[model samples]
Target: MPVFRRRKGNLPRLVPELDDATLGQVRRRLETSWSRGSLDTSVIALVARAIEDAGQDWDRKAHRLEVLAGAAGRAVPDMWRRNSPNDQGAVLLHAWSDLLQAQRGAEVDLAATRDACHLAADLLPADPIPWTLALATLRLERRPHREMSAVWREIKARDLWNREAHLQALAYLSPDECGSTALMLDLLDGIRSVMPPDAPTAGLEIITLVRNYHRAFGADGRAGIGAGEHWRRPDIARALDQAVQDWLRPGFLTHATAVADLNVLAYALVKAARADEALEVLRATNGVATPWPWNTEGDPLERFSHWYGRVGSA
Candidate 1:
């Protein structure tokens, strides 16, 4: 017998509304739907939309759905017996939601995120969303190269051009003892090619590439001077400064691409000894709390603070 075998009776439906009371009501009903042991796809989709409408307060609804999704993933045989496509979709949606929450400074469990990603991978083999999420979780956990190598192989076997995959790969392949510059640049070029013209990601990739180029080849090489010295070059400084300004425009705010670009810009400015401008940019960017996941770190914050502090003393 399936865990979510719908009783041969009337099924409960969620009420439509964007208000708090209505959202609350819908959330409760969805919980009940999950408790019945059957994954309800329609209810899952509705709940996802409702949570999105709630914006920052989506946490409450997301928590409830995440429990249900986990249950469905664990009870796969039961879900299959119940013929519950909804249950499957609910699992993926809930995982994606949880991953987003974790990316946000929330206290979500890494194990849960990994499990969700694995379930999503099995359920949506053709979909890049699950693979992307899984790769991200692996990177966050800082798995060994052997483990990451397998994940990277899977990604490469599929669509190597996916934005999320490329971005995640960029982060995973750092310039530290673990990564190769030639390989990283190749990945960056792939990322650059697929970036949309107006997308802030294009600018962000350019900055990352430039930074890495200098790091690998040194200031005097073909990539030009290091950021610290490049500011002395009027043309180079002007171009970078303009790119930073373009990323700060109102239309680009709240985008992951913009956040990455701003982070790179902040670093570039600091290295160029423009502490005041760096501080101003960081302030405008909300100082590290951008909504988009994937690249949230304190390194930029610490570096900016140190740079500004030193500038004040000087």
Candidate 2:
């Protein structure tokens, strides 16, 4: 579970201690960190927090969101181009989808979400998040029943972590299924394994899983099981507050993971009806500080820019 410390008004100021050259180096490292298939998870955690802490400054938050998305996009193709599949690439793709999905419902594009899920599946066959995303995308698209069942079956056949499977099951199963509770618990176990060691944001995946479970089952049923579980508490509003803190704590943010973590956390919070917190996180990151507007105005070269703008706006 994430460490939840109340934010005292007395929280220490965030001093920018890095010199320009050092800052540039850090940025470069963050931008390219995914090439190795692993990323500094803490860095991403921090980015999420920074965005959350940014509060109310849409322009700044937007800029930060763009930067985070741009870096992730640049690193994504490298995952597929390599001879071996990279987990970070898949993670980044999912991260992008998480970000896009968090936007106002009207702004979401099923095609883009589908593309992101497909990319993630191609990059990390072992990880179930992408497949789950694909299923969710199908649901969003209102695909026919047969296709949905086929997708669900395919997901079930994979050696996915239990929580992922439970999540998939929750997405597709009827509530009366006798073993659903046990399945969710098993899913929680899987999430525990994936939590980053020594990072506040480690519990995020579990939080997301439980939240989704609740959405599928309602507060009195599956959602109420972990009434007080650190990450699965029924009090979604408080959980969101804690998630923001975990993502922003000084030790958690890193360049490579920032955008992805922020995207996921923001989406989760918004879905839980904590849009105010989500907006605050985005603003704190100075996301809109950059003047380039995702570094694209027009033309093919501006594809990255366009993505950046969309990410920020979302």
Candidate 3:
């Protein structure tokens, strides 16, 4: 069986290590779905996870989803095509959501998008992807806060611990977007309070902190919370410490997004100049790169490799 062999400079392609057989299964599943009309919840779920594993580069990620969605749509039988609520109907909704996300920067029709999402929600009443997509579209379009909140509530009502939904909400609440640092922090606090310490989202607080820190301080290492000791705010430090402790334990955050969470933690620790802590995270990551905090500084894997070298030498 083949595997995703790790290399130091595979920029934008770093992902969790998947053995050849498992990876082949995922590929075959996707291919089969595209060839025929196997637009079930399982197919959509697999595609959703693939999107997450593609890292945070919106254009690249969107393009992959666009292809899958388009191919799946074209396979639908013409006799069964009026968007009635069914498995194929849900997939069609996902296709619309994908196209909307791909065209995020350009002018979009909000009303039509919302209608599509609503129809998706009706089709997949139990699935959280539609709700997550709604939150993402609202974030991209910079829709009203109340509207975002309403959709957020709908998501939480369905699956409170949905990682994708929380991520979408986190991006919407970041200082660079609709929310300020305080608002983002508050959102983290609320999530932390409700989530168990071992839950996958236990690492989100640190991710949000890192995003806000970068937002306040430009890409340059200078400014904002200051470098080294000065960067250690009590609240942020406490949150990071707790996240680190929880993350290091056995069986913690054994989800598909585990590597992404670690990527955020490692990036945050490096920015804070906590070399030892960052090294711990890097060691755990084993060179799997997820964009997030490192995209602003050029190739994420390159930055990760540079920092790993510095920490190792130190």
- Best-fitting candidate, measured by TM-score? 3
Candidates arranged by TM-score, highest first? 3, 1, 2
Question: Candidate 1: minimum summed lDDT over ten consecutive residues — where?
Answer: 9-18
91-187 per-residue lDDT for model 1 (tens digits): 5555655665666667777677668666756764654555666777777667777877777777666554444565667777766534666667776
TM-score of 2: 0.32
Best by lDDT: 3
User: lDDT per model, in order?
Assistant: 0.52, 0.45, 0.63
Give each model a TM-score.
0.46, 0.32, 0.72
Off by over 4 Å in 2: 1-95, 98-103, 171-314
- Model 3, 96-177: lDDT tens digits are 5454445645555656656666776786576555666677778777899999988888878877676767877887887778
296 Cα displacement, candidate 1 (Å): 12
Assess the local accuracy of residue 187 in candidate 2 as a C-alpha lDDT between 0 and 100.
49
How good is model 1 by TM-score? 0.46
Candidate 2 C-alpha lDDT tens digits along 1-314: 11111333212122121112333343455566666666755555544544444343322333344344545553433332242234433343344435444433545666666666667667646544455556666655556657666766666566332233344455443333323555545644554566553342354453455455455654334444443343345665565666677766665654323443454454455444455666555444433222211112233224222322333445
* Winner on TM-score (1 vs 3): 3
Ranking by lDDT: 3, 1, 2
Better of 1 and 2 by lDDT: 1
